[model samples]
Target chain A: MSEFGSNSENGGRVLSFEREEKCHSAGCLELVVQGKATHYHGPRNVDSLLRAMGENSLYANVRINGDVLDRRDFENVSIKTDDTIDILYFMGGGACST
Target chain B: MFDLTDEEILRYSRHIILSEVGGTGQQKLKEARVLVVGAGGLGSPVLLYLAAAGVGRIGVIEDDVVDVTNLQRQVIHATADVDKPKVHSASETMKQINPLIEVDVYHERLTRDNIFPLLENYDIVVDGVDNFPTRYLINDACVMKKKFLVEGGILRFMGLIMSINGGETACYRCVFEEPPPPGTVPSCAEAGILGAVAGVVGTLQATEVLKIITGVGEPLFNRLLQFDAEGLRFHEVNARRNPKCPVCGENPTITELIEYAYTCETQAPGSS
Candidate 1:
């Protein structure tokens, strides 16, 4: 609704999930998960469970389980709305900085 | 009158066989002009393929010389060619690959002052440059000149190829926003790359060049093709033109070229 997708908010919890719940793009990810307070997700919030698993940025594909969740797939994806989101890591390295 | 002889027809028969590329594509390639910056790892295969693919006019801009270490991945230059100017060595090899193609060699580095005038003549620009400064410079120049740019980069075993059709597609800065500070990500010399990775990525770039000229299937405009050689997988990332990009934005901020020097104060391990 807010320029990303679907209807306006649709009024529900916006629980955000990334492998370790971190932000890889240096941008912020906000989740209204179940309409509680909007959970601010980024590199600064490193203690959360979603981020503890290193789910910040994925290479191959990321699947989310919930229908209400807003997922931004950076690369390739085959999202399943009915199940928990899965992250498939590819190119397990960084790009050249020179 | 770029007539295809019997041998020439046979050599390019596979290309002419495709409805997308046919005889018309062959002719386009013969008339196409390309400007290649940096004759290093990425440029090597790109130059080789573009030459062999029959791009009529190919220009190479490189200031560096061939070093012993560069031979590991810069395949165009031979061991005997080491210590020679890369533009000279690369031109020799490209001509050998296809004497029919014209090779314009720039013996000096591509700087802000020189890049504009140097690039104005070519139909397309291929960025095989290793540094961010040149990368950004080439992109901005292409956008300013309304030229197509085939950009590629390699780090370790992974690489990506994307073509910027200037006003038509998202520029490099649209996706990356800004380059990481120098040395934040290690160079191939520091990280070590799989030599063949250049061949893979550079070949893809050459394919893009051919596609652009031939008007073939799905050019990589507005999309980034990512390759992971170790995993043997390829993926395409959708890129959006940033309204905020300094070069091609609605209100561009970078009105001119700015030189940024990023070199280690201390000598690297294999520093000459």
Candidate 2:
């Protein structure tokens, strides 16, 4: 019973079956390829994912499987093959007209 | 006084046709007073819709002038508006959209000493600002004063929006409590934002405002909506009122407003 309700975790990414084994090198089929945004390597741990994506990790807010993960938890959280990660950072762009 | 004229009736005929927002809802829009802070990216679409929708009286506050860089994402200001004060450019454009609605402009900075008086006349507040300090300030002020606020943020392809009813719903601080300790805060660089991203989030904020004024549909309320444009997906998270929230919690530690200091820009590539 976490704060987040019954909504689909990992955003709306269709879960492509559960991972039976921890497959590291052979490439994970369900990787949410954030291409062009960063030189993304197949990230296993949160730090590697951030490093691969070239994200600063300072103010970047991370959420895995849709649950909000604190900055302190970044080092501890690992990525499974089926996991979906969303990193958000808030900025000041008032009047933010477009 | 909020009655619609023949022209006003004709103008909003489309809105009047919707069963959920007939003549009564249009009238609610006419009588509503909304104060929007920042005339930049997010404020652009919000001002356009609220004015076009015939929101009775709209107040816009801005201390920045229109720049060459802002013309791309800030749709309300024209290329000719480059050197002009943003409040003037925004108000002029809003008036052009709908002369029926009254627009009040404040060409000054919002500060701790002046925010209360600035918020005195408006019923609802909209946060279209681009910095972290002001966002936190606006959130805390609205929470302490018990005002209805529609919060929006966008960067690159990411967009976040939430509606706050002060102490009743979850405030911004309730979910993301870290405002950074003043001097300890480092400079945050801006990543280029897709111009359309602002439009997407700002339009949603405007929709929430219209919904709130008319009492139609579910107004985002305690739900945080995140839009990832790359995936074109919308994710929602339910947030209950945190009983342990510092400002709005049962115990309530923050009785007074606190102003945070930030170095350089807060985050993302946004112009205000």
Candidate 3:
């Protein structure tokens, strides 16, 4: 049911997004990449990693080492072995008026 | 310099008793002015705590009317106040908590033209807003104005809080860069936030604000504090100031406020 149903595993770890009902995708629930955890070395390209984790939807913002990965570069972007990747998103519902 | 009355001394005795926040620190609080940009969930706790801490002048802006649904987490409002403007309703509660402090209420929306003049009077600004556009707007404004800003947000069981000393520290834009395109991220209404999650983040924002006012402790500057209520754990992200950040970077690009046309709840293009 995931948009990216690739077979290769992702290289970086994931954060609170796995099984996070609000998260965009599934299949990467077991990987914990918050702060400094373990790193999977399968795919370096962000697109490939996201595809492998099934979180490849363009909607989710990919953050690598603190910078927001440009949407145009997701396909070819490379993640270094020491890089930290966080799949982040947000909600709009505080005072609601701002 | 404003002096704390005998009654205020008794009321904030616990705070004044602390070596870090003695009479001197309490006096600083009395002279500090803070602006809170929202009256909903996160704003609720920020308002309550700041008011209770005896912040001299507290200004709140919101063009929203309270709704029944808000009762779940917007603790500052009651069922009876559902039809009332959020600012008025929240201000009343704040006054009841402490009649000594002044609560300035603005029942208007914050716009690019008005943000500067509005923020000019306050020493610190707190972002308890819900939407991303407003979040980025507040950050950009504070960074440009060189005012301290305490930013917090909640979605589901996750919450993020960070403090920015205007251009000196890592701003919201420095960490998140730009608001994710609308429809890409879910809204609290759709994503479902735990009511207490807002409390957790809002209270933290209030703490950061007080810390800024009294200069007592280290604020969350250059650090993004992430909270997971479900797991009851906290995560800290190093929010370093980036030279390439469009807003606070060396050669800034976002010279003016930018408002996204759509809210977060907007459905992505054609997706069902």
Candidate DockQ values, in order, are 0.09, 0.17, 0.22
Q: RMSD for all candidates, in order, please.
A: 9.8, 6.9, 6.3
Candidate 1: docking tier: incorrect
Number of backbone clashes in candidate 3: 2
What tier of docking accuracy does candidate 2 attain?
A: incorrect
lDDT of 1 by residue, B59-143 (tens): 9988788899889888899999989999899999998988888999888767889988987779899988776666777888888
- How far is B13's C-alpha from truth in model 1 (Å)? 2.9
Best by TM-score: 3
- State how far residue B205 of model 3 sits from its true place (Å): 0.4
> What lDDT tens digits, residue by residue, belong to model 3 across residues B22-68?
99899999899999999988999999999999998999998888878
Q: Write the per-residue lDDT of candidate 2 for residues B200-251, one digit (tens) a residue.
A: 8899999999999999998988877777776676766665676767788888
The Cα error of candidate 3 at residue B241, in Å, is 1.0
- Candidate with top lDDT is 3
- Candidate 1 Cα errors over 4 Å, as ranges: A1-98, B1-7, B264-272
Docking class of 3: incorrect
